[model samples]
Target: MSLTLQDVKRVATLARIAVNDEEAATYQQHLNGIFGLIAEMQAVDTTGIEPMSHAQDLSQRLRDDVVTESNQRDKFQAIAPQVAGGLYLVPQVIE
Candidate 1:
């Protein structure tokens, strides 16, 4: 679980962070602590435990699916800066 200076440098490069020597040493210590915690978690026995999305036992209410028609095309198109043939238009980008 010990993190080296090379590991800190690699992590800093991957995260796009500029790290000085002192900062790199500090981050090495912090990363070692985090890895130690992960090692401890890996040692725990969870053989029969079921994976769950939430910690609490609660059911989420969902509405029944239904399709409906909407007729607000003109109302919505009126607010557009540019519209043509029931569609919004934008400036051309690629040349």
Candidate 2:
């Protein structure tokens, strides 16, 4: 896959980026190189390969699901300007 100077200029215009002739040519070469790498990757055969979540074999360590702190809802609600039915009240702005 290859990209032309015109194609690079058009892409730059669409992206709202300023590009001179020299920069456009450079970008065209870079884009063509990236497309060539993608083409090479697509040429590989992986018929029996299984998809992996991670490249290396590893497992996440988890802690025990137990309460570590006591409830302090009453203490917090005591300091609020307004609270009703264990919920804080705020002025409604929308109609």
Q: For model 1, where is the 10-residue window of minimal lDDT?
A: 64-73
TM-score of each: 0.58, 0.71
Off by more than 4 A, model 2: 74-83, 89-95
Best by lDDT, which number?
Answer: 2
lDDT of 1 by residue, 27-54 (tens): 8988899999999999999999999989
Evaluate candidate 2 by giving its C-alpha RMSD to the native, one decimal: 2.7
| Clashes in predicted model 2 | 0
Candidate 2, residues 1-95, lDDT tens digits: the string is 68889999999999999999999999998999999999999999988999899999899999999999999999999999999998999999998
lDDT of 2 at 53: 95
Error of 2 at 27 (Å): 1.1
Global lDDT of model 1: 0.92
